[model samples]
Target: MAASVIELSDVSVVRDGNTILDSLSWQVADDQRWVILGPNGAGKTTLLQVASASIHPSHGSAEVLGSKLGAVDVFELRPRIGFASTAMARRIPRDETVLNSVMTAAYSVTGRWNEEYENLDVRRAQRVLAEWKLSALEDRKFGDLSDGEQKRVQIARAVMTDPELLLLDEPAASLDLGAREELLQLLSGYASAPSAPAIVMVTHHVEEIPAGFTHALLLADGAITAQGPVDEVITAENLGETFGLNLSVTRENGRFAARAA
Candidate 1:
């Protein structure tokens, strides 16, 4: 097995007298792509915050890419971790070109200012756009794109810096069926690439679990219900327990689907 890219031990996060994450322990390794599934308020996003070095645990320790969260300089560590979420996308300038949006990630900034970028940076951004099938939309405005297009562009931006770990929150949450499938296919292809970064995506629907994901983590109310291989951890019973309803999980053509029983 590859080295652990993320390790959390007895981690907990408290805010406003409420425990957002409760003594959670999890590990992610290189070459493994994970899907985090749970109901609302399950601390799924909180887990990603810890993994991305955006927050320190209220208790226990977290080591991401070999650097302890509280002991290391997080600003230095954050650049190596790529995170893309709807909140992050909301910060992007509406009129910014897609190319610049992706390129700005190289500088760890959101909006482009008077900063000068070298030709190499431009070419790399172009390549990332092409890799995400957005070469034709490079000149388009970020706000001009559809929800699905915007999601793809955000992912392209997240990975433009070639991060060691990628964290995505609901990358397929709002898309229609065709758009969702298209993004899923693209994600499946990206996950299969040998050089792609380790990925952890948070999604509510099992149907959103892209192919090539190796592991699953089921969370309910900030505690883990199951954690292991996707097949073994995401059983119907586990899903039912996590969601507070009886569920039937079925797989077809290498994808997962869940329904309330």
Candidate 2:
């Protein structure tokens, strides 16, 4: 069996006396690509935070990349994990160049702040840009790019470090049809590659899940309603339960769509 990338045992997180995650237990293997689906306030983002080591569970055992949370230094552990989210994107300077935005991830900083990078780093960043189809925009300022371009940039930066685990918080959110499909194609390619790291993406819409994702976890009210192989866990029954609405789900050409039943 593949090594476990994340292991959460009876984990619970409480904030302001409200339970965010209630005794949740789950595991993600290094070879798996998982998509988390849930409605608003379902604690999906919070779960990603635990996997990223950005937050420790208020109770229960949480381990990421073989290191136990609260026992290991998060700063060191975080470099081995790639995280891309709107929160992280906001920290990036608007004036920063695309190449610099990605290169600074080598040091885990938001912007290029006098931190020196090696020749190898520059080459690697350039290569990543090319791989993500952003080579033409390398010199462009991050703020000047379209939402699609910026989303791709964020993902490129996340993978720049060659992290062991990649966590994306709604990578396709707010994108137009063209942009969303473009990003999904790139994500599917990456997720299907043998060298790709274990990935977990949180999104509210089933349409955003890229091909090659192997597993699914449906969360509701801070708990797992269903989880396992993507094919089995993403059924209409599961979707309906998670979202509190009767939903019909369909799959075609390795993609999924859901609608009200």
Per-residue CA lDDT of model 1 for 1-261, tens digit only, reads 698999999999999889999999999998899999999999999999889988899999999999998899999999999899999999999999999999999898888998999999999999999988999999999999999999999999999999999999999999999999999999999999999989999999999999889999999999999999999988899999999998898999889988878
lDDT of 1: 0.94
lDDT of 1 at 59: 94
**Candidate 1 segments exceeding 4 Å error:** none
Clashing pairs in 1: none
lDDT against the true structure, per candidate, is: 0.94, 0.96
Candidate 1 — number of clashing residue pairs? 0
lDDT of 2 by residue, 65-166 (tens): 999999999998999999999999999999999999999999989889888889999999999999999999999999999999999999999999999999
